[model samples]
Structure formats: C-alpha cells, structure tokens
Target: MTGKSQIADRIAARGASRSAAAAAVDAVLGEITSALAAGERVTLTGFGTFEAAGRAARTARNPRTGEALEVSATTVARFHPGATLRARVAGGSGEPLGAVPDLGSLQGLTASEPTPVETPVPAATSSVKAKSPGGATGKAAAAAKAKAKAKKADVKKRADAAKKADAKKRADAKKAQKKADAKKSSSKSKGKGKKK
Candidate 1:
C-alpha cells in the first residue's frame, strides 16, 4: 500500500524539504508516464521498465448471461521488474537496494509454510446399491428413458423448424430476384418500342 506520498516522505527524510521531495517525485513519475504514453520504454536501472504493449482483438463471453462479445485491439501499459527488485522481493541474499526502504512495514513479508488441515473420510454404507450399465431398475429407468426420448424429439422438432424457415427465406429471395429481372426485361422492351 506504499503510494507516491509515502515515497515523497521517504525522499524528504534525506534532508530535502517536503515540497521539494514531492515535486521531484511528481516530475519523475510524470516523465515516466509521458514516455509510456508516447510508446517509449522507461527503465529505472534496478527498479523496472515501463512500456506500452499491444493487445490483439479477441472474443470474450459475458459470465452472467453466457453471451459472447468482441473485444477490440488496443495498446496497454505494462511493467517488467528488474533483476534486483525481483531478488529483493523473493528474499534473495543480494545487496540492499536504495529505492525501496528497509522499513518494519515490510518485515515478516517472507512466505510462511501453509498449515495442513485434516479432512474426515465418509463411512461406507451397505444400503447403497452399485449401478450397472443399464442404470437403476424399474420406474426410475423408465422415467429417464421417457425424458431422454422427449428431449431428443424436441431437438429434432426445432431443427426441422429452422430448416423450413431457411427454405422459405431462400424461396422468397429467389422469387424477388426473378420479379426484378422480369421488370428489367420489360423496361428494355418498352425502350425499344419507343425508339421505333
């Protein structure tokens, strides 16, 4: 949660006035932002590199309604941390870096071992029957078979309806095209008659 103000405070601790430190921090950050906006990479030796990366257009889905959507391609800002910063964050035995302060706030930041939890296993019961390839016997299987048949019939009906609709649309289009051609031909004959 270390922000720009905290960074300026850290800088001010090294003898500079608070306003001067804030201005310096603001100037540096503004330059970095400007460079990135102009598609230039800004690299701070032991900190990170900032640049604009192009993203390709893609199709995405709406999670709520399961509807598909298209996402347009664009350029986005990206950051890549330098080796020293990576090593420090990973608790490597490297020399201390100057940008990041050795504060108590960062203490105990090392990864801790996860505690193991005991899960109870369910007791087996003899009353539950194992299923065969044909499934449960009697009424349940009959009901399942009937439901499956009904679902298949409904799917077939919808498919047939869609096919009929497509056929009708094509037929209408063909008829309209024929009428246009006939009209064009009639106009051409009328033009010849007028010339005579």
Candidate 2:
C-alpha cells in the first residue's frame, strides 16, 4: 500500500528535504518508464529488471455472457526482482542489502523496529486458483455446475408447459368435432321422420 509519498518520507528521514526525496522518486520512476517505453530493459544489479514484452492479438471470452471478445495485440511492461532484492524482501539473510536504501522503511520499518516477515504475493488470480494439487479450491467448478443445472431445469420446465398446452388444445378440438357430429345426426333423423 505504500506509494511515492511514503517512499519520499523514508528518504526525507535520511536528511534530504521532502521535495528532494519526492523529486528523486519521480526521477527514478521516470527513467525506468522511459527505458521501458523505448523497448529497452533497465536492470539495477541487485534490484529488478523493467522490460516491455509484446502480446499477440487473441480472442477471449466474457465469463458472464459466454460471449467472445477480441483482444488487440499490444506491448506490456513486466518486472522480475533480482535475487538480492528478493532475499531481503523475504527476510532471508540477515546481512544488509548492499547500496540499496533501507527496505525497512518501505515495509513500514523504522530503524528501531525489526524487519517484519511477509507472505509472498501469489502470481495468479486466486479466485480460480488451487490451494494445493488435488485440493480445496473449486469455486469456479462449483459455479459452472450450478449454472448448468439451472439452465437444464429452465429448459425442462418450458418443454413441459408446451407439451401440456398442446395436449389441451388437441382435446378441445376433439370435443368440438364430437359435438358437430351429434348435431348432424339429430338433424338427419328429424328430416327422415318429417318425410315419412
């Protein structure tokens, strides 16, 4: 949750003015951005790499409507932290990170405070992710099964109603036909009796 202002605060704690710290933060971000924009990789030895990668155009789907979507080809930036930065962030190796600013401040650590242990961020979207192999998470699968069951129920209900309606219509037609036949027979009988 820490942003540029927070980062500036840490640098300010190091005796630089707030404005100077802010300017330094902006300058570093700007240089990294410019390098990535020019399709170059900016690697700070013990920090991380900032690079741009091209993505191919592809078709994707809208989950709710099950509709297809067109995704245009584009370039995207990616960052892969280096071993030293990773180690320090993970609280591994009690040795200090060489030349890097106090990572502690970024982690809300003041010099008086010890480095806090943190859980690593997951790389995937957790909603559909598995907790472990063959285990625990089935939210997406359960949702799909429920949706299919509801759809089948809806179709069966409509079909049953249609069949009942058709049966009722045929019975009404048959009754009308029987009534007409009775009327014709009665009229014939009356005509024959009158002629006699």
The most accurate candidate by TM-score is: 2
Native-to-model Cα distance after best TM-score fit, residue 155 in candidate 1, in Å: 52
Candidate 2: global Cα-lDDT? 0.67
lDDT of each: 0.66, 0.67
Q: Model 1, range 1-196, lDDT digits (tens) per residue?
A: 2345545556555445556665666656667777877899899998889989999999999999989999999999999999878978798644323444443333332223221222222333222222321224334455668999999999999999999999999999999999999999999999999999
- In model 1, which runs have C-alpha deviations exceeding 4 angstroms? 92-196
The 10 consecutive residues of candidate 2 with the worst lDDT sum are: 110-119
The all-Cα superposition gives candidate 2 an RMSD in Å to the true structure of: 15.5
Q: After superposition, how far is residue 44 of candidate 2 from its true place, in Å?
A: 0.7
Residue runs of model 2 more than 4 Å from their true location after superposition: 92-196
Where does candidate 2 clash, by residue pair?
none
Best by lDDT: 2
